[model samples]
Target: MAQDSGAPEPDDKLHDECGVFGVWAPGRDVARMTYFALRALQHRGQESAGIAVGDGKTVLVRKDLGLVTQVFSDADLAAMPGHVACGHCRYGTAGAKGWEAAQPHLSTINNVIIALAHNGTLVNFDDLRRELIDMAIPFRSNTDSEVAAKLIGYFTQRGHRLRTGIAHTMRMIEGGYAMVLVRENALYAFRDPHGIRPLVLGRLGDGGWVVASETCALDISGATFVREIEPGEIIRISDDGLRSERGCRPLTPANCIFEHVYFSRPDSVKDGSSFYLMRHRMGARLAQEAPVEADLVISVPDSGTPAAEGFAQESGIPFGTGLIKNRYVARTFIQPTPELRQMGVRLKLNALPDVVRGKRLVMVDDSVVRGTTSLQIVRMLKEAGATEVHVRSASPMVTWPCFYGIDTANQDQLIAANMDLEQIRSRLEADSVAFLSTEGLFACVPPNGYCTACFTGAYPVQIPRSFYEEKFLPGYEPNNLAPASKTSQMTLVQAEELLGQEG
Candidate 1:
């Protein structure tokens, strides 16, 4: 018998890289606070969860291949008590999906110990890993995060302070990342130069501080939102005080727009507005751009609810629940036969005939990746007696692959990248299908620089030729917004030479 890999059935959805949480609080249960924060951020990643605590003397880490709830219990939390801690929930985009690949990754520098929780992919980590291997630095996993931890350890072992080592590592590594690191008595947080990922700073009571990938995590931990961690900024919190420093020069801001369209929880705030409102505005703009005459406006459950309500409000169509999702059906480790595998979507969602029967439904979804789920959902709705099923995507079409932190398919696998609007509608067998225009999407979010690479094919960070050479189909060229060669702000040789000069 073939053993199941315990991975979720392959679906047509873009996955965020991971979620990271860090807190510096004395005379409090920091581990439990981190656990609750990770639970709130469970939507960001589900494959693994881990927490590392610094109890003033040494750093302790516990991690495994499971959800946060599954990975820790009351006793587990009680065993690990600390003043500073960091946690991670992973939906891996970079390396193997195994116990060893789970983070917060731990590394040592002589007498000092540190653990790192990261949320993004490092584009140039392959070369950096090779360099570290050549220098005889051992690695426990084939993950960019592990490489990052080892790089910091290597630099710190060379007589530099931990913060200095981190700054040097920030200069040498390239990609979109939001990282939270913890040593025996201090907590550190930083972001990449481009700010392609999200990280927020929050105040916990009078003497504590917290940082997380989303504001929702702060809400769960009773932390008040302070502000976003600036691009290339490093924040350190310890007994002495909280301080901020520049890890590297900030590049042009390129926040991932998908966080507003999807990824983030509805209640999470960004730029003084909730993601629910942003998505609602996206649906309203979408309705203005692509209006369809339908008797009912229904969403694909939780993710698309706000958008569907906005569409209904804009189009004067009555909104109702047409599909019910089985909340418990997250992932199944069972191996099914071919015929049973075809019925996979049925295991997660079911159509409500009483509500949708004989009604013309405009089904709104977050986005269509490969169109497989949309097609199955359309057929299911029709089978449940929906008169006509018109599909509406709340966001613009995804035509290019995301290299920063999102786990999107290759260019050839994306439906919009390979087919036109009519072709997509035909393939899904829907009455009609329409997506939000890119301009309309921009109008819905706060005015700021964004990485529209997945929709516009214009990459903010330079992608290595060796990395993306075979990722695209023939004749589909990517627009490199940044210079094509060096992804890192400072090369490893330059950094090492600078260190030599300092010596």
Candidate 2:
């Protein structure tokens, strides 16, 4: 479905740009299974959906720019008969959109079909893309996932086995990626060296195998959770069963901390910790770190409910849903004007005057991104006659952008980046505001087990300054992207010359 170009775009939330699901079930409807699992993981992305299925002899792929339900109909799933399948939901991390940017990205090598779905961003995408372009490898989309797929295809055609090819590509690529790829006979999954994104393996009751971005997908597919694919591990699944390899040397694991704070479903588990429990712990810690006097604890809804409950439990304040979310309203719309964008919040959530009237409220939310929504919601609560609203965030302030999979704002757009806690409180029109301390956040999770770079700017992966600028300025033309005077539209000779300079 096409978005209305004239509608105001909702711009409040942080979005993870992709989710991946894969299954190798010989006797099952793998395509439908993938559809269901993708639905379970849909919160990670919304721009597009795709599935690629493969039997022993043939691979079939269908993908489009829509929600998972809109893209794959029952008829479409029924037509794709296969023993192995991979699915993807995407949120357009790169500037590109439409059908062209949808995954599972398909490529052919030596008559073998390969379809891949990826869940993270590549920091060195320019370098890798330049290499592929110089080699005259045509690209279907402007996505780092395609670069990875083409590289894997290139190596497979050079006499390397599929697993070997993927392992080699992993070595050459830099940045966070959790990927699931399907070939005619098998399914392959791997994660980046830092594991900035989450991928987990699961077991089907009928002796099949599954791998997905989160455990919730397994639960929906009736698969039992097994374990997370290690930071640098690769696993291959075929009729002969599963095989594993250490694709790259492990760096300190940097599993995204936001997965617990926001991105992941509470039902999902990562790194042996339940995301729900971690979030609850985070809220409890927040209450300890920033105690507040309040008559009621209210949540922002859905994402904030769990933490709000924890805050209530720790503070001995009653927890109530003072705001109700309109489940049918889409998260985003094409708001063409700033005025309409500001009004869009009421369409998504409404304050309950009866619940909040004359009450001093402690409102717990997962995190504040740009602070626009926070201000709007606070103002809404005030209009409903709340005496005071104290904003409490379960996570430390997000002051930096995420370079992994998450679609975070540039530092300039982040409210915490430009203002202190008191300044943010004033801007949000709240009586008081406090965020979970960084140390409190670490205490809530496994020690040194996750990435807090968005809060601390301590990126586990070294990043070039240019990558940050490239995200907002699409078609970024830097000397590193092209050579001295060459543009991306240059011919093969120009790309080759650029590569030669790098060599």
Candidate 3:
């Protein structure tokens, strides 16, 4: 919610769960490395920080619900002295507050002490949770990482080594998930086969290697950027040396397109595409899909610029700074008052009276979460300028809430999921409005290589149908949790147990 660039705050807020950082080193400063990496990832999640260090058999963990500096003291990391370690900074897949749900979870079942920090959501969480519960596995947190750890334990119990256990871990569930796992002497890291989220490898000069949720973390840790962990690819770092293995059951690559538009840091490269450049392409594609004869292709600013340039290029319209953004705005815009969002729009963006005195202007934006901002911005453009105003969206309508870590689980809030494009355009009341066609949007990225689940209804992984629409409060039981009261019902839950919360 924080606007790092001091731009005007949009009516709707963007959502993300958090980022994780881990390191495997011999006589190396893993703790310091984690600290810097988490700092880099602070934008991913800001609610919690945790670190777990390992010395072969025994592991030391310090975790709490607070910012990295608030939760960890120099003494905390000093106490965790180890050769290999994993750490987490949490935002919440859906955990709004329950800070008790902070991660780097360690469940000591048998002699194996497994600690894991997860970055994305697991779609099969409820199904897997029920399956484990029926078998009497007790669960501790609401996080999908518990399911990840339990999955890891199942494979390790079957005598699979770190690599095989990790490879097998991908076979059980679905959705976007990247995890860093720590054991006695080795550190294992893996990404879901679809590669819906991102995980990267970095190497220190001392030969110590790191696995991070984003390249920004590697930069913060002063680690050299290595290649990305490919979708379904597994990497292991130990005394023997770093090795790669094929993991997840092969499937079409579906990296989350939203990552480039919003979630990831602009500097990081994901799946071989520059995040900023990808946005530029998306904007251009949007222009092609929804063209308008206008004086300038003004972007919403910040996140909307790259796409605006693309739109301008394709439309043959000169790209102009239609709106000037204020740079002093707070990083987060949790408006204290009811009309703060509207005020945020005004304070953040200013129409160029010189450029728009009588010009037909085209506006480009990333996504319209709710119609409030779209309506508001459209009105502002009409007031500022010329004859006609056209609105072009870079992505298709978002009809579904992402249960996998994105906080927009409240279905009632999503406008496109319920209304038709015509309805939305009418609601905004613009001269002309068009969304990027589904085909056009897909063509903007690699073929069939990103999670369009939010735009399309085809969920790549199996999740409890109820979960997407369920009223979930972290650490609360079903009796205490209320239903949304309007979502279509599917299967009912049977009292169940959990295996473990692993990845």
- Which has the greatest lDDT? 1
Report the alpha-carbon TM-score of model 3 versus the true structure.
0.78
The list of candidate 2 runs beyond 4 A from truth reads 1-10, 331-340, 470-503
Rank order (by lDDT, best first): 1, 2, 3
Candidate 1 lDDT over residue span 107-155, tens digit each: 8888898999999988888888988898788877889999889888877
Could you tell me every candidate's TM-score relative to the true structure?
0.96, 0.91, 0.78
In model 1, where is the ten-residue run with the lowest total lDDT?
484-493
lDDT for model 1 comes to 0.89
lDDT of each: 0.89, 0.83, 0.72
Q: Alpha carbon lDDT of residue 483, candidate 1?
A: 73
lDDT of 1 at 9: 58
Prediction 2 global C-alpha lDDT: 0.83
**lDDT tens digits, residue span 11-99, model 3:** 55456788888899879778777877887787787778888888887877788877787788887777777899888988744353455
Residue 348 lDDT (model 3): 69
Clashes of each: 0, 6, 21
Which candidate gets the maximum TM-score versus the true structure? Answer: 1
